[model samples]
Target: MEIDGQPLWVAPSIYVDSKEQGIISLGHRCVLSEHVMLLTHDFSLDRYSEKMGIAPSDMEYETKGKIRIGDYAFIGIRSIIMPGVTIGDGAIVGAGSVVTKSVGDGMVVAGNPARELGTVESAWERNQAQWQLKRRRP
Candidate 1:
């Protein structure tokens, strides 16, 4: 819940962790879709101790890294944002993407491991064409 700026839209089912340092940092104009999980840590069985009566499922594993999303980034539905991920400005994550690494500025990523598909330049081109068509339509 550490939002660094304003005009953010987050879906209801987004799982956000705010306990650790920079666990979730959302810049201005960021959009998080439904069921998107912004995780900071992973629970491991090694943390469990039999003598301490701690169950493996009850072990707590803290975040070794942070999740930072820059301005104007859009995280699609059901996306899993792993720790230590810095998403640059204007980046777009497609639906159900599992982001394991940092995404470059204005890039489009999708699928498991979130491969870079293209850049925002393509989107800008499409937008320009639409505008031209509208102007020509009278």
Candidate 2:
């Protein structure tokens, strides 16, 4: 596990599987909320078992790859970041997201498989507008 720079916020409740040989790198100012899971390895027991004509329980096969979270990336609570995923700089992952692929810089992604919703700047602007509206309400 390699964490670079200062002021990175990783919640204590988050689970990071570091037993595999693959590296897990967290960049500057990255924030991992509670219950976030960073997986560096994926089990291939079913596929291996089928190929070998054996029970999945009897098979011990895994695919390992590095997980890199770029600078200023924010992983929301209960999100799962799969192996070999490189979250780009300034990316925003919505809560409970299942990230299966790499996120582009400043992109905002949400839901299972984590599809792109919009850019960070647009989301921020929307948020600001909502805040202003709320302030005007009684």
Go through the candidates in order and give each one's C-alpha lDDT: 0.82, 0.87
RMSD of model 1, in Å?
Answer: 5.3
What is candidate 2's TM-score against the reference?
Answer: 0.83
lDDT of 2 at 43: 73
Q: Candidate 2 on 1-138: residue-level lDDT in tens?
A: 777775278889989888654398888989899999998887756686767777555556778779989999999999999988999999999999999999999999999989999999999987875654444322
Q: After best superposition, candidate 1 residue 96: deviation in angstroms?
A: 0.4
Model 2: weakest 10-residue lDDT segment is 129-138
Tens digit of per-residue lDDT, candidate 1, span 1-138: 578897378888998765765567889988898999987776444465534666455555444568888899999999999878998999999999999999999999999989998997896776665654444221
Per-residue error at 73 for model 2, in Å? 0.7
Q: Which stretches of candidate 1 lie over 4 Å from their true place?
A: 45-63, 126-138
**Candidate 1, clashing residue pairs?**
none
